[model samples]
Target: MTRRNRRMARLALPRLAFLVVPAFLAGCASPPVRFYTLGAPAIATGAVPTGIVTPATPVVEVARVTLPDYLDGQDIVVRAGNQIERSATGRWASRLSLGATDLITAQLARGRTDLFVTDQPQSLPATWRLAVNISRLDVTRDGTASLEADWSIIPHDANLPILHSRAAFTQAGAAATDGDTARLTQAVLEQLAERIVAGWPR
Candidate 1:
């Protein structure tokens, strides 16, 4: 209404706009992070075989599954040319080691009827222990994933020998989206599981 009041209102408008700009930029810079899990697509699922149970059947325990320190974290890792980088908007649902162990254990249990496999703490002594150490795990935005690991199956009997081996897997698919990257990873892990089962000693 008054001249002084009109000028003051115009000055206040610029100050309010400046204050709002920073908050808007912050929101745009940070998007909601999505979580993914390894071996979630169920590519290697099998119904557990049922039959007359035998006490002589062996139980294999997953002693441990470990990944490189950088790859063990929750962030989704990607290979960008020669450098490795973490995804900005995606993360692993659980630590890579735990997820990998669970995936392998579940498959091993259902894949064979003559043997049992578990990662849980067992009260009864296990006949065999399996240890896996992952040295390399990476995925590209283009949907190619690679995994390299060394593993061993050790017998509880001191006189028995251990079986040690290394495996590498490469999986390619549509990986431009985060979900696609996750599925690509699942494919890699599924292949790894199949490799492990094939190596299991009869």
Candidate 2:
């Protein structure tokens, strides 16, 4: 081999080694994934303030909720215009489909004790059934949480007519952190629950 070529090869080896070592170290030091949930804590007995009368019980079942394909995973999704990104180090405590359904049902039950909320078909006859389809539910680059859904309230019995409507809602997140993103999403869902209950027949 020529002396010049041999010298060049030796120099290239050190440069290649320098590039790979840090990448290996970085992979080892990467942070672990953090998980979050939107479910509310159990309400203690008598914790509710006075002067609020409980509404009459309404038997309601929340049918399986449908979410956009983008949010079918455990990772939290965020969007800005045409760009969308999933969290690398933060994730949902439960799958989005199940989590969203439970979150909404719980929120409704909390406000109105007379309402019985369930995710599955219950043996107890339900007077009303709620079905929700979410078109958009994501945090934006500006730290805003937005949700758009088409929801319906149908009489469990086929004889009764159906009530359907659309709701588009948004709320600013607590902060730029992942926890805040989750909190903002929960707040948006609470608003959605309110819209659904407001349509209750007199």
Candidate 3:
């Protein structure tokens, strides 16, 4: 309408545009989150056995699974020269401890349907219980996922009196992409499962 009013309107337009443009750009620039599981596709196909057995195997309970302080967070963590960085867009579908427990249960039950494996507290009498503590689990810049853990199994009761064994191990993951770190992590867990089964009383 007036000359002064027109000048004020022009000045306001640039300020409004400056504020709005950045907000719009930030929204567009922000990355979308990509969630991943600990295992499945990355592990070798048919590596897990199939088919149910005639006699059901003993009930096994996953008592507890723990992770290192650095890896206890929700984000996908990578280690570089003793510095750990969390991925802004890459993340785990669930907690690493829970994922590890689930992966361990699946790997053990893959071939042996007879064995009833569970993560919850045993309602019925549990013949065996497993506890695992992971010290270091992270994907590095070198394209390798590594896992270090200690685990043990305890039998409720046995005529043969199975001895409790405590073992610690370090396993390397094989994966082509950084995004496939979960797969490599799963492979490491499979190796841990095999070790536990090997020590089970026959």
The 10 consecutive residues of candidate 2 with the worst lDDT sum are: 44-53
* TM-score of each predicted structure versus truth: 0.80, 0.75, 0.75
- Model 1 segments beyond 4 Å from truth? 1-29, 40-55
- Model 3, span 1-202: residue lDDT tens: 9999999999999999999999999988967788888763232321324444333457778765799876775678777778987777788888878777777776665644456666777667677777788877767766666667777676777654445554444446544444766666666776777777676555
Candidate 2: tens digits of C-alpha lDDT, residues 101-174: 87667665666565566667777667788899999898886888889999888886898889889989999855
Backbone clash total for model 1 is 0
Q: Model-by-model lDDT, in order?
A: 0.80, 0.76, 0.68
Task: List candidate 3 segments past 4 Å from native.
Answer: 1-8, 11-19, 22-28, 40-57, 158-178
lDDT of 2: 0.76
Model 2 per-residue lDDT at 9: 97
Inter-residue clash pairs, candidate 1: none
Better of 2 and 3 by lDDT: 2
For model 1, give the 10-residue run with minimal summed lDDT. 40-49
